[model samples]
Target: MVSDFRKKKLLHVFTSFFDRNGSGSIDKKDFELAIENISKLRGWSSGDAKYVETQSALLKIWEALQSRADSDKDGEISVDEWISMWDEFAKNPSAPLEWQNLYSKFIFNLEDASGDGVIDGEEFSSVYESFGLSKSDALVAFKKMSKGKGQVSWSEFQELWKEYFTTEDVAAPGNFIFGKTSF
Candidate 1:
């Protein structure tokens, strides 16, 4: 079961990223908006390879989320439904679900703009800035997340990603992964 603190963290992600249309639920339209926003942030014009790849990745995420979380089959995932889905995953933290792995990989790839298999401070800040977080906050968060290492490798990011979803420790560096969450 997800604790209150973890639920708060999950809710932050839902509101901040998934519910892009402010429609009170997650649906295909929200993913579409995310694709547009992220592609625009990366300066990937329409028909560009990057744009097409992003479209494919995000749509796959949406499909996975909808199939797993939309319990009512309403073509949208309510906050309660989202929490419920995560609760099941939290029951076995050692085995992450497919969508979780996919989402993490997507985020890592998105943030690793240099294609160097690691995310530097600038790359981290730029991606979060696109999510509407301030660059200063992102840098601070990255510093915490990287433990002053100046960059985060894929293995490190995967651990932080898992910690973000599973740990209730307010002081965990993973808490800052999305940039200065109130929780």
Candidate 2:
């Protein structure tokens, strides 16, 4: 069962990220918008190799999510459907989540603007700012998640990613991975 706290956090993700079109559900259009927004953030113009690659990756992610979460085969994932799929995953945190791993890699790559294999504060803040979060708030989140290390490596990000999905503790730094969430 998904704890109420976990559900709140998941709902935050749905509203803040997944439901990009604000249509009360996640669909292909939402992923399309995400691709556009993220590519724009990276300054990848249409027809650019990077833009095309990102579009492919994001569309794959959308397919995976739709296959797993759109239980009614309605070509959309409602909040209830989204929560239900996550609830199942919550039962076995150790289970491999391929789509999630792919998504995490995508985010990590996006944040690692320098391509130096890590995300520095400036890079992190810039990506979050594209998501409509304030740079100051993103820096605060980066500070907490990085534990004052001044940067985050892929391994550290993976752990934080897992914590964000599995931890019930409100104070967990992973709670701010996507920005500040109302507890």
Candidate 3:
């Protein structure tokens, strides 16, 4: 059984995805809206090759999350469904490695404003801030993740992703991937 703390952390992670509307539930409409917002924010366009790749990646993640968690098949995730999904997720943290890899790649691409295939410290800070993490903590995380390089490449980000999901160390830089969580 998942402990309360782990469950809360899992809930925070899951809710972060589909609770875009902040209605306290993940419904089809909310998911769709999130996709729309993300697509727009990421500059996804039909004519762009990156769009197809990113869209495919996104669809894979969406399908995985929905198929695993939408127990009622009504295209909505209730709190109970979230819990049930968390049970499954907690059982195998590495199960979603591909999903996480794709997600991290997409995020890296999104944050690499210079199109140089790397995220500078400032860009990384903005990403953290965008996720509601405090600036100081973002700086701390940036320092930890960048290792004094002041930039993170896609491969480095993948390593960080692995560490984020697998590491139990609260002091690990990966633990702060989502921000400094009191939980």
Off by over 4 Å in 2: none
Clashes per model (N, Cα, C within 3 A): 0, 0, 0
> Best candidate, TM-score-wise?
1
Q: What is the lDDT of residue 103 in candidate 2?
A: 84
Give the per-residue Cα lDDT of candidate 1 at 139.
Answer: 91
Q: What is the C-alpha lDDT profile of model 2 across 1-183, one tens digit per residue?
A: 788999888998898788998999999999999999998998899899999999999999899888888899999999999889777776776684677777889888989999999998899989888888889988888888887788889988888888888889887877777765345
Best of the two (2, 3) by lDDT: 2
Give the higher-TM-score candidate: 1 or 3.
1
Note the Cα lDDT for every prediction shown: 0.88, 0.86, 0.65
Report each candidate's C-alpha RMSD, comma-separated, in the order given.
1.2, 1.3, 3.6
Candidate 3 lDDT over residue span 1-183, tens digit each: 656655555566656655778877776566566556655655776667766665566677667667767778987778787777656644675676344455667677766767898888777676556555677777776777676687888778767766655555656666555545445
Worst 10 residues of 1 by lDDT: 174-183
- Per-residue accuracy of model 1 over 9-73 as CA lDDT, tens digit each: 98989998899999999999999999999989999987999999999999998888888888999
Off by over 4 Å in 3: 35-60, 83-98
Candidate with better lDDT, 1 vs 2: 1
